[model samples]
Target: MTKAANFIWYELMTSDPAGAAAFYGAVVGWTIAGGADPQAGGVDYRMIGRRDGGNAGGVLALNADMLAGGARPCWMGYLHVADVDAAIAAIEADGGVVHMPATDLSVGRIAMLSDPQGATFYIMDPIPPAGAEDMESDVFSVTEAQHVRWNELATSDPDAAIAFYRRHFGWGQDGAMEMGELGSYRFVQRGDVMLGAVMPLMPGMPAPAWSYYIGVDDIDRAAAAVTANGGTITNEPMEIPGGEFAMNAVDPQGAAVGFVGPRGG
Candidate 1:
């Protein structure tokens, strides 16, 4: 049996690449490399390096042409699939839209897509480097700092979104938390690893989208770094069921993100 698809990579599309690099570097303790000079004028793709020497993701500079074409600052994840074309077909048949058709790059074959409710993400069939065929991606982790710890989707339709993801990615609704009038926060999992949760859009959420939570060692210090670096804390840190605190914030360039860590006294 083939292994199920999982989110293997993440990228941030931002208008201010230099500023964003600085912001995330301070907040999440990431090292930004490449494309330091925005005025140099090329495809500005900066690699996000974790302290442990692993790459967490990348930051893409959105050009004027892209901005005019309706591109905005946002964080998108790449889901690794067995076949890119087959995944696109399955998505379209289930009411998802193909924003960018499958294109081959040095990294792999990838396509950008939006779900039935308009949450955008990418599907990739990666071509690993020579002698790295057996290597697994560690960009996402549940307990490690400086990695994506959770993937939450706030959509307009919870039931349909859950069903669609379940059909395509083999995600199971293992449990949920009742949120009074807001509805249930449904947790999604693949085998024993809890990926994240899906729920209806809250009152303050701008639209239907996926918000990724980056893990930090200290929640309170991370929140302070966000504001000090010109980012805005949208949701203050609050203790979750597991005793850790989760908070939401928008980057200096306006991309919404979240952080999960311990609230050190």
Candidate 2:
């Protein structure tokens, strides 16, 4: 099936927006812009933009009202779908559950969901996308604009999860990356470029979950930002077999995040 929507925005609902903002800002060299005013009940969020004016992302304040409403600290990415209603139906038919029904935001219509294994994401209609290219510009930076780029889900059952996305998102192409000890990661692609990787947990990992990546200039310094901002370094910066560098860290809210650079970001 055709990938009608692109993931344009990712809002992490976690405690400590200020700290989260600082962590991500330093890691990705992202500039945090003014957010919507507070008196209106909107989040004390920030617009995360690439340093070189490449692309823009978002951040939100995680609060008690959110957790009280069953919200967990997690990364929520938005998929730009042409028809949000149809996408919602497809997800439901494919064993996913809709946590929040289709709701129209100032941008477009969106519906939050969880895959059969509980990985969460949202299907939406982006407000003013020129096309996939512009949507990509909005979703991630230029260096990150691949056929399918951004969020990768690490699951317990890669094969089954791949089959699920194939049916649900109808991805046209894909390939696999062998992560020495972890296992072979089968990517769900929109075309030639990999949108995300479906990695099965190696051992002792309780459940399948999703992790997000942001392109940066320096992984070493970025990893340090995690610790500086009251976060924990899950994985130190290391050179992936290929020509890239990356590190994994836990945000203040305990959500996992990854920072990738061209060899040494």
Candidate 3:
């Protein structure tokens, strides 16, 4: 079983599920399948399946009720926890806020939460299917082409945000990169694996949030697909530390997603 405090599941809550499916399907090469989730009162819920086989994430359509309540299209990260209630208590004590209380579900207990610095994510005590391995083990691995490659946070207070997560998820600083006037980009780890980094939010960016990078085979091709499929490339493709190229984009429904891959012509 995968240990607690690791990223397990991902979800995109969008106003236009079909549009999101179409846009992401072309950009990331994911096949959107699956029917409505019965537990969700038969709301249209789709699975993002990778080309190599296995689910990457899910898409949940935001209905009129959700939109009326101010729900917007966004990608949410799920961090595994051993006890959702206990985690909630710790989070509250550490200046975090609960957007949704812990609730029972088919998979496990889950709660929507925002860290002290206001980056939203979920904490789930996931229940793997019968005869299956830990959900985290199957869903999150570097070798998988479509897996989430990184969890990047752009926040107003990186130091305080890193400290809050270090206490909650046992994430530690691995290294730091000086960004001159923008301050430092600090890498974070859960044990020995370097998951991602935290940096100060760029001016004019939306409120503090976590941006997940999806792995791809070619960065330039994916960026082009993003624009061609009705999405906007918010940032030009750039080289990262491990020789990978990456870029950020907004889907047609306005959800932010990142792509990481080799440079393409």
Candidate 4:
């Protein structure tokens, strides 16, 4: 089967890796392991493991040099592509900026890029482990708890963003919801799966960015946990179309994140 351009991994670049790990562990119920080890390129990278024994994503500790270079704490999603070099070239031709040139790693060839509207994400061509060639990534799921359920893009130009993503990644606009002055909330889908939505940047959103919403068992409990752990709930938990509640939050390290689940009584 041909590879589809879908988000296969999520990552958090934060100043305090240990604190961010603890905060997410309490709020998202993820067990983080692996720290800065000289054996692993001396990078302070930790793995985010879900309860189901699958990896949700990873956390990379931002160093002083990264901060000096204006790298802020943020959550980034990696979209798997079949050809990273071709994707990078196409993206650049379509007004997208390539922040990091395509480079080969032990696991894959990857590159960092931003949409025309400045929403940043990564494109990776992953290499499966030996004998696991047929294994699919479960880091993104629409209903499973602890996995990313949604990948939302709030952009300065939704129409152009949609067009660019569709042209390059084969995403489709399944439908849209009218949001009055805030504009339309356009749902994006990859084949049959409803990935997430795209909407205009709301007031107080500093810039165009993507927000990955992780699935939780209880929305209310997660919202409370956000505050109890020094994180700020930007949007209160509210019912979405599918009867589940969702909320936007800012982690203590200043990265924006989201959660979606049932609001248990």
TM per prediction: 0.95, 0.85, 0.94, 0.96
Give the higher-lDDT candidate: 3 or 4: 4
> Candidate 2's residue-wise lDDT over 1-265, tens digit each?
6453446677666676666667766666566655654432465766656655744556666667877887777777876777878878887887889999998866678898888887888887767644543434356432562111356787777777877777666664366777798788776666554566788875765667777776666667667767887789877877764667767777887877777776443
**Cα RMSD for predicted model 4:** 1.7
Query: What would the per-residue lDDT of candidate 4 be over residues 152-231, giving only the tens digit for each residue?
Result: 99999998998888888988897899999989999999899999999999998889999999888899899888999999
Task: State model 4's lDDT.
Answer: 0.90
* Residue range 183-224, candidate 1, lDDT tens digits: 999999877899999999999777789999999989999999
lDDT score for residue 215 of model 4: 88
Any idea how many clashes model 3 has? 0
- What are the Cα lDDT values of the candidates? 0.90, 0.68, 0.85, 0.90
Looking at model 4, the pairs that clash are: none
> Using TM-score as the measure, which candidate wins?
4
**Model 3, 58-137: lDDT tens per residue?**
88889899999999999998998889999999899988999999999878899999998899999998888897754345
Q: Report each candidate's C-alpha RMSD, comma-separated, in the order given.
A: 2.4, 3.4, 2.2, 1.7
Judged by whole-model lDDT over C-alpha atoms, candidate 2 comes out at 0.68
CA shift at 196, candidate 1, in angstroms? 0.3
Decreasing lDDT order of the candidates: 1, 4, 3, 2
> Which should have the higher lDDT, number 2 or number 3?
3
